[model samples]
Target: MTTITAGRLREAAELLGIRNQATLNEIRARYSERVKEWHPDVSQNDPAESHEMTIRLKEAYDLLTDYCMNRPVSFRLEDLEKDLEQSPADYWMERFGDDPIWG
Candidate 1:
């Protein structure tokens, strides 16, 4: 229902130093670190920058948290089983090496 753009999402991710595919906990931890690093009460020497950064960081945190909270998730048994059961070679072989010529 939100009207967020891809650019805005990318900005939020970059602001919080989040890499691709972060879980909610990772996003929260990164936001906490960034806030602590820039909060005006803690970084008194640069209160102006700290204040500005704190505001930006909070917005980024809210955007990221909102996006994550609304994302759809799957919990099918086969999906979980696939994650736990795959080995590197088996994965490659099943997908690529199964071809008679390639194998």
Candidate 2:
């Protein structure tokens, strides 16, 4: 698992041009705007710089998304899928047993 330090969070916020207090919607908006400005296809300037900036922007968006979702910054969907697959069928049965929707 990767540790997300305050410095890393700060750097991500800076890259996205946002504050820690920014909401998920705000972060998404900023990320979209930045991506549009730096995307290689959209930007006519240095392709290398545009590519680099786009990468950084994506990283920043991912980090902030994880934080806002209360998930580890390095969390992966594959890991969750693996864990779910390993769980016994009885686990889900028990979890949803009382739900009328599952009846």
Candidate 3:
């Protein structure tokens, strides 16, 4: 199996200007916007610069897409609702649940 290092994932996210929690559609949209901006034939930048940016954008998009594709996702209503229902308190409680003070 190919290793997907955290640094590579972080670099991809940074290139696409997305947070770590972005959805697939968001990634796609961002990639499309970036490609349109830097495509060699379309950009105002010098062709070589545009080509370089386009390559970087493609690499970032591919890395994110492949990573996301391999990860599991749940789309059930209950799961969705459960995520939405989590408050700041719930998040902290989950992390510190076994501690005496936090519990």
How far off is residue 55 in model 1, in Å? 0.7
Residue-level lDDT tens digits of model 1 in 1-97? 5577888999999999986668899999999998888889988657888899999999999998998898877789988887879897887787779
Question: Candidate 1: minimum summed lDDT over ten consecutive residues — where?
Answer: 1-10
lDDT of 3: 0.90
Pairs of residues at least 3 apart in sequence or in different chains that clash in candidate 3: none
lDDT of each: 0.87, 0.86, 0.90
Global lDDT of model 2: 0.86
The segments of candidate 3 whose C-alpha lies over 4 angstroms from its true place after superposition are 74-81, 87-103
**Best of the candidates, lDDT:** 3
Regions more than 4 Å wrong, model 2: 71-103
Q: What TM-score should be assigned to candidate 3?
A: 0.70
Better of 2 and 3 by lDDT: 3
Q: What are the per-residue Cα lDDT tens digits for candidate 2 across 1-103?
A: 5678888889999999985468789999999999999999999879999999999999989988887899555448988786667566677586777889984
